[model samples]
Target: MFSTSNTLLYADKLTDFNMPMPHIYACHLSDQLIQFTGPDKKSYLHGQITQDVNLLTNDALLWAGQCDAKGKLWSILRLFNFQDDYFAITSKDEIENALAEFKKYAVFAKVDIEQNKNHQLVGLFGDDLSAVLSELEIILPTENNSTIDFKFGKAIKLDNNRLILCIDKKAQLPSCITLLESEQKWQSLSILAGEPKLNNQAIAEYVPQMVNLQAIGGISFKKGCYKGQETVARMKFLGKNKRAMYILEANTNKPFEATEVEQQLGENWRRAGKLIQTSFDIDTNRAYALAIMPNDLALDTLLRTKQENPISIEIKPLPYSLIEE
Candidate 1:
């Protein structure tokens, strides 16, 4: 079990981002929308995604990944049933193209795939979420419960304290709240939580274990086969996976592209892993980064960037335990 260190609090500057603040984080799945309906909807998705769709009782949230034929993950999706339709939310950049890929194979299947760009999905995350919901008098559904009754799209409890409120962009939310103006604080929270955003730069670069997916209940090994099942299972059972995701906090303002190799040690660049998400808090003079690296490197090891101007980076232990031995 990983606990927040006092060093983290001392090293990073505290922000005025208080509880009940309405912070907006973009859900990239809007770009890669797959609307699965008709008689074969459940069976169709079960075969495509990494998780078992039958496990979701129409009211629960299903976290799954879409992998290429080679078993590399192209998209991570959060699937949920909204009445008669099944929505597969994936990365914005890959979703549009992923939908087309699915459509081509789904010629005989009755399922229909389309991108829902007009409807924007935002994640309202905070630790004191219960208090926020109590103030709004809208009790967000639990992870197992679907939000179809609330009519605010759907809500899922991502963690012990974090609550995800999914709402349609065009639809008006009854809750009285204003958007908080701090992107830095939100990014910090995500890093501390070890949650990586689904983006083009990081997509298809690592398997589920590389991003701590199995530790977070994203992968269901016991469930039967799905896309890339052979590779995922083989790696897990045979101890072939060597890399895992880690949250690194650094003291730098320079921008780094995700998945780009930052050369260190010598001329040869170690393509061990890729950067997931990062943000700089100008007030704190610090930046936060989520990167996936080889397990042998050892997590929480402090190091310096190999850029023209090197920066100090301290890797923090992720909240979840790695699946690799």
Candidate 2:
């Protein structure tokens, strides 16, 4: 278990981030784990989510979303299977709300839903992830989203370069693994990776496509009869979606919270989109934000903040292409 003293020690190490490669950090502060177990678990989830739940394997994790009848996202999460049950990792603030939403539909199903606080979510990043895990005698799934049982925990490969380690809260971390102090670094990394997550304020404000969920493998158009399936399917087939997620960077003295994104229309600034998530590197004075904006908007469209002191936005390339597949 990571104790109070351990946390302090980890915080101290964060001061000198120039440490050697193969970094590991506690990510539980920003994320929470929700578990679903029952005979009807798969079928129940398959009917309520946008991803094809039936395709989820014990070895892989799935990115999915739960949306309302109109297809607005309620929560976007990482789903995986462990110990004969299904577990989802989502923003901590949305855990209870998501649980409540899950229960509303799970009432008739045999599934049991509950928060699992016993596990701590940790992020492992660096080129030496495989080597470091090998040193700890941990074997992880090689394929992206795949998972494997490790010592008293589970290891999931979010991608080739990043892994999410879910360890028992009581388990002591290996000496080589260094815990990150601030979540800003992790958040920054996620933005660079173009992974869009939802917070309390942004819930029910975006459809999956608006956030580019389909481009990120979070949506499955072929899946049958999930909540909001009809609307989502129509958008997919009709290609009428006018908004999409984009990465924007700005020079700011401090981090910017989620807010409205505006485009300059001649002499006037008009509402063009909404900022979904952001991370600011204090040292660099650069703010990175993910916003949903008009897809057809010209690349030269001048975008700025809608607040009193507006910041200019510069478009940045996402790791993946936004073109619909």
Best by lDDT: 2
The sequence of per-residue lDDT tens digits that candidate 1 reaches over residues 1-325 is 1111221212333443334433322221222456777788777777776787777765577677777765677777777776677887665566755676667677778777777654455445543455446643566554532443355456655654444555565554323332334445556666778865556777667777677777666778877667788888877888888877777776656544344324344645444456777767675566777877777775544455545565667777777677444
Clashes of each: 2, 4
Question: Which pairs clash in the backbone of model 2?
Answer: 1-169, 1-170, 1-171, 61-145
Candidate 2's residue-wise lDDT over 237-301, tens digit each? 99878888888888888777538888988899889988888888766577888888888877777
Name the lDDT value of residue 44 in candidate 2.
91
Candidate 1: RMSD to truth: 7.0
lDDT of 2 at 133: 80
Whole-model Cα lDDT per candidate?
Answer: 0.61, 0.78
Residues forming the 10-long window of minimal summed lDDT in candidate 2: 8-17
Query: What range of 10 consecutive residues in model 1 has the weakest lDDT sum?
Result: 1-10
